[model samples]
Target: MELADRVESLTPSTTLAITSKAKALKEDGHDVIGLGAGEPDFNTPEYILDAAKNAMDQGLTKYTPSGGLPELKDAIIDKFKRDQSLVFNRNEIIVTIGAKHALFTLFQVLLNRGDEVIVPVPYWVSYPEQIKLAEGQPVYVKGSEDNNFKITPEQLEESITDQTKAIIINSPSNPTGVLYTKDELEALGEIAIKHNLWIVSDEIYEKLIYGNDNHQSIAEISEELKNHTIIINGVSKSHSMTGWRIGYAAGNETIIKAMTNLASHSTSNPTSISQHAAIAAYTNSEEEIERMKEAFEERLNKLYDWMMEIPNLSCVKPQGAFYLFPNVSKIVNQSPFDSVDEWVKQLLEEEKVAIVPGSGFGSEDNVRLSYATSLDQLEEAAKRIKKFVEKYSV
Candidate 1:
């Protein structure tokens, strides 16, 4: 049987591959520590779950509008007002199965064949693949460890061309967990306005920030850029509702309506019950989110300190999100192993610890270790990694 050419060309998500491998090991009685998955270890908050139950009891099982339930869209509109001080009409919002799906729909709607998207290096594993699947070219702008894995406005300006259609800004970025500061975001926003490029801001980790600085969305900085910026956010990270499959994108009416039409013919709105759950997540402010943030912060600090003791392993303190992208080239390149892939493979096989190699995220000299696991697991995983590195020292 033949598959579609696009499906045939796409690679599976490396993060999911690592998670599946770890699960398979555990099923076979091996003790595996998985630090590859991106979701928080915390369970979906009780309030959100209760809302879903209430929805089911009230017969919310049937499908609603293609974009989203009106109530949920209103909740999202209200959320932007309360959280980011960014106002948008319900027509400007499109709710999808997840933030990932929202992004895919946006790409599919906006990109014609060969349209180039400026993707910063060390991006989320799925960004480039999703672009490729949509027949869009992902033009990567290299970011260095020296810059904390962020791209400068000058770098962004230099990458644009007539064919450049959009640029993805994933502040509080995945894998790296670096949050872009306000000034930095403004600079990039100015460039986007100058180039008339769409800005797809993935702010799913907005509430997961760990420092004194609050997470800022680009649209919040300027009224002119607000219409050009597509803000993608969800309750997945903030309320630990990953499985709820609810996310929304806010932007101009035309772009959002196009995405809504795409979703209508595709997934047809998000799950009815999940939308209800998301409504609760937005309306209610629980201390649980803060509690989870504290836990993640504690784990981040502990992992940073532990990694500091390990020779040749270095990581910048992540300001948000739950993963740490540490440069392990000192060990990977020096080792007899030929590549980062080989190093990661040997570590998983020998030490029963799973981490995603940076090659999957557009960097070959580092690996992403998710600290979303428990404190005990992080401690054990760090110990195993240290021992493995010591064994291979040059």
Candidate 2:
């Protein structure tokens, strides 16, 4: 049977594909190193797991409100106040299956057929696809290497059309891990206000930054900016709770209500057990989270240094998150490979190292390497990559 036309037209995520291929190879007994997976290597903290056990033991296992449990909402509200100085009532927040689901649901609620959403390239792979699923056009504004792969306010302004309904700002961005400063966000916020567009701020990586700067939510910029922005986040990246699958959105009550209604008919609620676990994750300040962040920071430093020393390759040093998007045009030009995808394929087959190609992330000159693996794995992967590049690249 044929699938829906929408499903047929979508490109499957290369990140998942690469990770799967690597796993398959490893299962076949090959010494494969996978750098395509995005989740942290850390386990869920003990305190959070204990909270889940307590919830189950206390018989809080029934379905929660489609929006979320009141207790969890309260905890998330406190998290916003404690971290970003943003305030939201319970009506303005909705717990979702994951941050990815939160974003997908928001687009479903916000977009009408033919409406446009401005996505900066090389974006999180799902943005364009989700917009398409919502019958919205994804209007991509090209991000420049000179600006650390972030779009300028002028670039954003130029991409808007009369049908532009919203713009997605993913600071501490995925893949690149570059962050936008407060002033930069303020500039973009003003443009959003001028255009009367919704700002979908994906701040899932807020707690994963490696620099001196803290995450500054665009919603915290001003009162008007707050009203126009929908903040999407979760404990997935921050607390290493990806497997638990809890995420949330904070926005205008009307939009949030619409999204909650949609979720009720679809997911009903995030897992009751996971919601309880998330409450605990938000309620406490654990040193374990800091320890995990430190480990990622250390891995990032070692990986960055190693990558720089490898010839015919270069990448922007990431300020947050654990992935590195390295420009491999030097290698591509010298080698027989016509694109980064081909180059990545050969590397996987020959070196047994898996990396997501930039072609899937809307860039053809680079590949994305996730450093969430151990130092030993990264070092070995680097050595394999260096040998491959040296043998092939001019």
| lDDT top scorer | 2
Q: What would the per-residue lDDT of candidate 1 be over residues 1-394, giving only the tens digit for each residue?
A: 9999888988777778888888999999999999997899889989988999999999989988999989998989888999889889999998889899999999999999999999999899899989998999999998888999999998999999999999999989997999888899999999999999999999999988886868888899889888789999888988998998888899989989999888888887688999999999888886899999999999999998987888888888899999999999888767889988899989999999999999889999889999988889999999999999989887
Per-model C-alpha RMSD: 1.0, 0.8
> Model 2: per-residue lDDT, tens digit, 1-394?
9999889879998988888888989999999999998899988999999999999999989988999999999999999998889999999999999999999999999999999999999899999999999999999888898889999999998999999999999989987999999999999999999999999999999988986968889999899999999999999999999999999999899999999999999999999999999999998886989999999999999999998888878889999988999999988889988878988999999999999999888888878999988999999999999999988965
Which regions in candidate 2 have their CA more than 4 angstroms from the true location?
A: none
Off by over 4 Å in 1: none
Model 1 local distance difference test score? 0.91
| Angstrom error at residue 199, model 1 | 0.4
